[model samples]
Target: MKVAIYTLGCKVNQYETQAMEQELRRRGHQVVAFEEAADVYVVNSCSVTAVSDRKSRQMLYRVRREHPQAVLALCGCYSQTHPEDVEKLDVDLIAGTGDRSGFLDLLEQAAAERRHIVALDRSFDHRTFEVLPAGGLESRTRCLLKVEDGCVNFCSYCIIPYARGPVRSLPLDKAAEQAAGLKAAGYREIVLTGIEISSWGQDLKDGKSLIDLLETVAAAAPGVRLRLGSLEPRTVTEDFCRRAAALPDLCPQFHLSLQSGCDETLRRMNRKYDTARYLQSVELLNRFFDRPAVTTDLITGFPEETEAEFEQTLAFIRACGFARMHIFPYSIRPGTPAAKMRQVPKSVKEERAHRAAAVAAELRKNYLEGCVGATYPVLFEQPKEDWFFGHAPNYAEVLVKGTDLHNEIRPVTITSTDGEFLYGTIKE
Candidate 1:
């Protein structure tokens, strides 16, 4: 069978799609491109917001309309949370967030019998983590190791907790083993990713936290660079900073989730921490690592967010001086609490997003300028035009005028920046 998968949303979704592709290939099925003809088409969808949900629906509808004869399967967050909507699409097979292997079995069955199959369990009833193989198909430079799954944090603006259930973590030993395997497979970097990586050890009851898992994986893969996914601000404590700083191979880039920087907006959003605590996380990272890149996510014009509140958020983000930021205008998710609250006007949301983006751009320029004189070990990934591109430990994209540098880590001395990429020369 020829199977093609189209993934949408976060890195976790991309990782899951890769795992599915590997499984299909392992079963002697040919995995084709989504554009090409195939026996099966999978839409690993996302529903982070209404926009995300719309995209998922559009993709599914297009696939069904284009290839009416092929078996169409739906999985991931969108289908997990809104199965009724998905069922209306007449998809051949529908699987939720869990049970990848079983989902494949149903896919095969659906293809063979040409029957509609819906295999979805109550997400909250799941207690164990569904472990899947890590690594990408063609890319050897970097791979994602999903150390945890599910989210218990029921923020007012989020529906992930309902879609993903409570926190279920991959065992420490299993994570280490996987890290070692990825290292042996010649991967230059291994990223620790999850639905909520900061909540990694909550279900284990072993008292081992994310720092412990980091230590174990670092030990297993001595030379592989270990990068982390988005973390909760509360996860960054004095002890965590100290322990994480001790890991020689850990990437010095921390992405702390800060949806809004205003206290009142944060309270309305049901965020666990305020701007002060988020700033402390940034400060702690700066204290422990030399010029560590601190990145974040911000949502503007959330429900009932006043202009003063938006200004406060801008001021707070300026104070924190993020190395990079992903700014989004607030979008309503039907099932989330924020959707029912007094909503901000769409125009206001977009305007606030634009203003926040301007501030973010300024901060990014400042951060990039600060990287002018430093030297870093850059792991080269690909070539473009006359330059080979890669990323530093701080996750700064670096370019050098060179060839044959793919998958090679070399000492690069920063010479300049065009407010976008750091241009450097490789030191022999």
Candidate 2:
């Protein structure tokens, strides 16, 4: 059989799609491009927001229209949360978030028997972590290793917890083994990804923390740089900062998840930390690493968010001085508690988002300017017009005129800044 996969949403979904492709190939099936004729088309969906859900539906419709004879298989968060909606579509196979191996078996069976298959388990029913391949289809230089899955925080605006169930972690020994394997396979970097990686090792009986897991993996992959996924503020203690800074191979870029900047709004959102705690986390990272890139996600207009609250958020973020930011307007999802509350007007949401974006742009320019005359090690990914583009250890984009820089990490001395990226030449 020929298989084609279309993935939407987070890195975890991408990782799963790659795993499915690997399994299909292992079973003597061919994986092809989505545009070409294929025996099966898989849609790895996301349901982080209503927009993601709509996009998932749109992709499904497009696939069915283009390849009417191909068997359509649906999996991931969207189908896990709204299986009924997916069932109404003309899909031949249906699956929830977990069970990739089983889902692949069903897809193969459906192709052979010419029948429909619906196999979905309850979210919380899963107890063990399903190990899958780590490398992605795009690049062999960087891979995402998912050591943890699921979130128990139950943030009001998120539907992931219910879709992914309780926390299931890969054992520390297994994680170390995987890191070693990735290093042996010629990957220069590995991103530790999960639904909430900060909550790793919570379900274990040995009482090891995320820091312990990090230590194990870092030690195993001494040659490759280990980049972390989004982290909760609570994980930013003095000890975590000190220990993480001591590791020579760990990347100095941190993405701390922050939805709102006001205390009352955070309370309504059921966030465990206040503005003060979040600021503490930011300060800790800055103190530990030399000009580390601190990135974040911010939602502008949450339910019942007043003008004063939004102002407070704006001021708070400015105080943090984030190096990189992604600002978004809130959207309603039917199953989340946030959907039932009084929503701010869409115009107001967009307005705040624009304002936040302007501030974000200014901060990014300032960060880039600070990078002038600095030397960094950059791993080139690809080439473009008159230059090869790559990212520094701090996750800053660096463009230099060069050839054959792919997969090679070289010293780059940044000479100038274009307000968006640092222009540099490789140090011979």
Candidate 3:
């Protein structure tokens, strides 16, 4: 059978989809592009918000409409949380967030019998971590190694805690082995990604933490650069910074998750940390890594958030000086606690999003401009038109007019900026 996999949501989802593709290929099935004619269409869905759910439905329906003969497989967060909704879709196989191997088995069975199958587990009931292989089909500059799974942080606005279960980690030795294997496979960079990487060693009694995972992975990949996924603000401690800084391969970009900056809004959102704690984490990253690019996520117009509170958020983000920030207007998810609170007006959410976006743009531009005159070891990913696009250690996009720079790390000296990316020249 020919399989076409479409993934939605975070890097973990992408990694899992790649794992699925690998599994199918191992079973002697062809893995084709989604646009190509195929026997199966697997939509690894996301349900971060109402918008995400709608998008997941739209993608699945489009596949069903376009290729009626192909089997439709709906899985991931959307199918995990709202199985009934997914069952209503013209899907042949319905699998939840876990049980990838079982999902593949069911997919084969569904293909053979042309019958519908539902494979969902009580997400939180299973404490054992599901191990899936990392890396993908094509040889790429960066690969995501999911070292952790699930989140315990039941934030007011998130459905992920339910969609993904309690914290389960890939043990330290296993993580090191995976990293070594990915490095052996010729991947230049390995991104340690997960639902909540900060909560990584909580389920284990080995006294290992996120830093231990980082250090272990770093040591595993002798020459490969290591990048981290989004981190909870609470994870960036002085100890973490101090230890992580010593690892030469770790990238300097840190994405701290800060939904809303205002203390009152944070309390309402049930965030574990306030602006002060978030700032402390940001400061520690800066203190340890030289000119580290600190990025963050922000939600505007949260439930019952006053304009003054929004302003406080704006002021707090400006103070953080994030290199890049993703700001989204609040979207209510049905099962989350924030959805039950007095909702903020859509107009207010839109307005605040725009305002915050403007500030974020300015900060981004400044960060790019600040890169001028700096020489960085950039891992060149691909070349397009007149330039080869790559990323510096801080995850800054560095573009150079060059030929065949793919998968090559070169010394790039940033000489100019176009307000979006830094144009640089590769030093011979």
Candidate 4:
């Protein structure tokens, strides 16, 4: 059968979709793009916000309309949260966030019977981690390895905890084995991704933490660089940074999750850490790893966020000097606490997002400037037109004009900047 998979939202979702594609291919199915004619269409979706929900529905409807004869499959966070919403689309198969192996089986059954199938289990009943083989179809420079799944953090603004269910971890031995396998598959880098990596090991009765998992994976793939996904700020500490810095393969980029920078807004959002603690985490990472790229995500104009609070957030971001930042105007997710609270005007949210974005752009420019005249070991991913694109150990995208640089790690002399990316030449 020819299959087309459409992935929406988060690296974890992407990783799952990649796993699904691998499984389908192992069963002798040809995987292609959604627009191309195919026997099946899989829409792996998200419900992080109402907008995300809308997008998921739109994608499902479009796929159904375009290929009316093809079997339509819907799964992931959106389906997990609202199975009925997805079923309303007249999809052939509906599987929730869990049970990938079972989902694939159901897809096969749908193909055999040519009928609708809905396979959804109570998300909170989920306890076991569904392990899937890592790596993409084509040999790529970077592969994502999901070390953990589900979130226990009930942040007031998030619906993920409900959609993802209780924390479930991949055993340390399995993670090590997957890392070795991915490295052997010719991946130059492995991004340790998850829905909430910080909550890793909580499911285990044995006292293990993310640091322990990182130690094992890093040791397993000493030759391949290991990058991390977004982390809870509260997880970073002097001890954590000290141990993580000792790992030679760990990338020097850290993305801490900071929804709001003001203590009052954080309180409203029910974030685990305050602005001061988040700053401490940033400081600790910088102190341990020389010139590490500290990145973060910020939500501007949260419910009832005053002008004074927004200024505090901008000031806080400027103080941190993030190498990269993703700024978003907070979107109200239905059923979340903040949704029913006093909502910020759309104009105010947009204004605050612009203000935060300007500061972030300035800081990023300065960070790139700091890379000038420095030599970095970059893992070349692919070549585009006249320039070859790759990432520094700090995960900064490095562009250089050269030929035959794919999958090679070489020292590149940073010489110029194109405002966003650093342009350099590989030192022969």
CA RMSD per model (angstroms):
0.8, 1.0, 1.0, 0.9
Output the number of the lDDT-best candidate: 1
Q: Score residue 279 of candidate 1 by CA lDDT.
A: 88
User: Per-residue lDDT tens digits of candidate 1, residues 277-349?
Assistant: 8888999999999999999999998999999999999999999999999999998889988999998999999
Tell me the tens digit of each residue's lDDT in model 3 across 78-192: 9999988888888999989888999999999999999988888888986988889889955688999998899988999999989999999999889989999999999999999
TM-scores, all models, native as reference: 0.99, 0.98, 0.98, 0.98
Q: What C-alpha lDDT values do all the predictions have?
A: 0.93, 0.91, 0.91, 0.91
* Candidate 1 Cα misplacement greater than 4 A, ranges: none
| Residue pairs in candidate 4 whose N, alpha carbon or C atoms collide under 3 angstroms | none
Per-residue lDDT tens digits for candidate 4, residues 1-428, read: 99899999999999999999999889988999877999999999999999999999999889878888989999999988887677778798998999898999999999989998888889999999999989986558899999889998888899998899999999999999999998888888999999999989999979999999999999998889999899999899898999999998889999999988899999999888998999999999989998999999999989999999988988999999999999899899988898988999999999999989999999999999999999999999889788999999988889998878889999999998866989999998
Candidate 1 backbone collisions, by pair? none
Greater lDDT among 2 and 3 belongs to: 3
Candidate 3: residue 211 Cα off by (Å):
0.4
Clashing pairs in 3: none
Which portions of model 4 show Cα errors greater than 4 Å? none
